[model samples]
Target: MTEANSTPSVSLKLLVLVAILVVFAVVIVLLIFFLCLRGSRSWKRRKLAVKHSSGSIPLVSKEIMVVKTSDLTPATTSEIGDVEGDPKKEADVKVDIGAVTAGKSEVSGGGAHRSEVSVEDPNIGWGRWYSMSEVELATRGFAEGNVIGEGGYGVVYRGILQDGSVVAVKNLLNNKGQAEKEFKVEVEAIGKVRHKNLVRLVGYCAEGARRMLVYEYVDNGNLEQWLHGDVGPVSPLTWDIRMRIATGTAKGLAYLHEGLEPKVVHRDIKSSNILLDKNWNAKVSDFGLAKLLGSEKTHVTTRVMGTFGYVAPEYASSGMLNERSDVYSFGVLLMEIITGRSPIDYSRPPGEMNLVDWFKAMVASRRSEELVDPLIEIPPSPRSLKRVLLICLRCIDLDVVKRPKMGQIVHMLETDDFPFRSELRTVREKDPVSSHADVSIKVPYPPPKHAETVEKSRWR
Candidate 1:
């Protein structure tokens, strides 16, 4: 009786152990099922949220905001030494897309078009989304004749909207992955950026795999055409006009660098990117590769991307980028403006192949006047030309830390006083009789004392 009872007890224990194991397994399976269901619901909710946010402008992400420097009521001078230069202390420029005409005359506030939207509107945000069909109709079925410009991003076509307004539509390349990325980047960078000098983004189209961006139509061609096109032996851009273009370009860049809260770094700052309207006002265009930088971050380690010959050495080598990189490119652009030469020309003799090297050589040899574009109708005065050249050199300094902020650049460009005016005065104090003897000391624009002697001795 005892043996039989013990065997039964052992069997019962085994059975209990099996039952416990089975129960644990079932519990695990149910838990997994519950987790999967919760995850699925979360994913669906996210998708729906994106869909709902599509038609209307979505709130700006933390990484980027549609905030301008003027909105913050910045101090007169940046704590980091970036100076804001406005001769009249005018209010921020406001642009109206609806009233924009391709070749309109300047309105009251120096803008080509009148502004309908107030800068203070909180509702103001990125542009609207257009159906693919609407874009197709606007471009007239993407006719070859409608193509106004072509770039690495895609082809730019001139489209006439139903409202009788003209627009430049960029049909992004069909590389599915890259096209989408660029579309998002451009929309974020350009949308809601309100500056007279910036090409305003009218709208965009993202249907299926296709991507398109519409910009305000600029009637006059880009700065590249004015500088290098087949205009004739004598270019129509007078010294005053060139200065105006330069100053405007500087102001636009200053706005981007210092005027915005999280500043915009225009990775590319070449002549081709500077668009001009009928009034010859310089509007900085092409933000396809632009990057936004918050005040907290000193730099971003990004894949080096920009036009060759304009890339800053520090950025190109290490892929570390900041506002200084834009300054470097702007310096190269200034060289192009002053010399009327491409940044890199393979056809030229080896010594002159690179514009930067050639320019440095010219400056070192005191042949600055020789490097001027012969086409310029009226030559800039010795002092004025020298000031611009010095600024350019300062911008391109290999020691990136030494480059001036864009606002400082604007102030230097617009101010008639030479940067080294004190040094010249000191020399004059030491040698009172020969104060004007040094031809290099004179500033630009209005000729200095002993102008005839300086003109005959140095400028010629």
Candidate 2:
């Protein structure tokens, strides 16, 4: 009887164990089922995103709200910075340092195009442009200290006013093809658009031989300065900062494409044209070659104008200009930021002359480690870096239609935790080698929306 009773107890324990095991199996199966369902939903959302991105004005998450720096209230205006240089002429300038407080004591009144037309001379009428003397004082003053930087465009200088305000003065020189057109384009286009990423056009001195655009002074300097090592040592630009700059530039470009009343296509998109704020935020500059594309029009019928390596393949082969052309250029910029090399030049690895061609092979083979800059070999995890590379693939797509919209591009960089992934750590390429702050803030534009949002071409 005792033996039989013991046997019964053992069987009862066994049955209980079996029941627990069965419950565990069912729970695991249910978990997997829900995971698969979640994955399917995500896939469907991505497909919908691609589908809805087909419109001229893409299906955006936020409604854009634009504010001119000149339009900032007096209380807000007290925060901008004053650039260095001459007094009398620079005083007329009102630089817009975007949202970052420039810390300048004063910014001039009226928007870039908001000023009233005036007639100063007896011979010329109200529409007549100013004379060289008045223009000189307005732009390049006789002072020797007014110079800022020089390039293919000519000399740039820092000009100050009697009021302690500062401005960047670009002295125009007649060098080559259609000088007047370049001048007119700056005056006309700067005459229209206004965005934080875009360099502010406080005033222009367009009187005869003295033509120059007075702009807001950028503290951190050009994107090329940091990316190309102009600021010394081949320091790796942290992946986060690079993504931030890329996102900012894309925002500015998107604004030109869809947000503006009459859409504008920045004919030129190069690293040299991108200017950085103190925080290393990239802003797209150099609108001299910008073309206005209207909603009703299919293409911009204009001259075949652009820098050599950065122009789009389609736009170069044919004169047809569109927003996608800028996308292609942005791809080149993306490649530069990734590899930390100039777009042009034959000094890369055996099969990699330009970044676009080389990046293609790497992305296809799933060998991201091969594509990153040599300076930053040990980069952040493959996931975060890979996401950046994937975005580059979209930006540099051979077919313009394949490229992601700038707004969508912004979403991917800002919202996605792509720069980080499972078991990923910092590598040289993705992390800054310098002692400076490797991390950066997201700095989202206030009231993120559709109307006034874009990637800033902040290289200028």
Best by lDDT: 1
Question: For every candidate structure, what is the RMSD over all alpha carbons to the true structure, in angstroms?
Answer: 17.5, 25.4
Across residues 1-460, which tens digit of lDDT does each residue of candidate 2 receive?
A: 9999999999999999999999999999999999999999999999877654433221211111223433322111101222212242221112221221222222357312211122212111111222223334544444566665777677787766434567677776666433344555554455445788888765554432335566777877787878776544445467777778888898888887878756777888888888988888777877766666667776654446677667776666656777888887887898888878777567767666655666665555556676667665356666666667666665765556767777777776776664433312342245333111111211111211222111222122
- Whole-model lDDT values for every prediction: 0.70, 0.58
Per model, state how many residue pairs clash. Answer: 5, 52
CA displacement after TM-score superposition, residue 381 of candidate 1 (Å): 0.6
Q: For model 1, name the residue pairs that clash.
A: 69-259, 383-443, 383-444, 384-443, 384-444
Q: Which 10 consecutive positions of candidate 1 have the poorest summed lDDT? A: 73-82
lDDT of 1 by residue, 1-460 (tens): 9999999999999999999999999999999999999999999999877544443234322111122222321111001111112253311112112111112222356222211111222333566555444566789878999998987778999998777889999988866455655665666567778898889998765444566788999999899999989999898877778778888888899998888867788888889999999888999998867777778878877766788778887877767888999998998899898888998799999879878778876776678799888999789998888888887777887778878899898888988875475755674687564312233623222211221111111100
lDDT of 2 at 430: 55
Q: Scored by Cα lDDT, where does model 2 land?
A: 0.58
TM-score of each: 0.67, 0.60
Q: Which ten residues in a row have the lowest lDDT in candidate 2?
A: 436-445
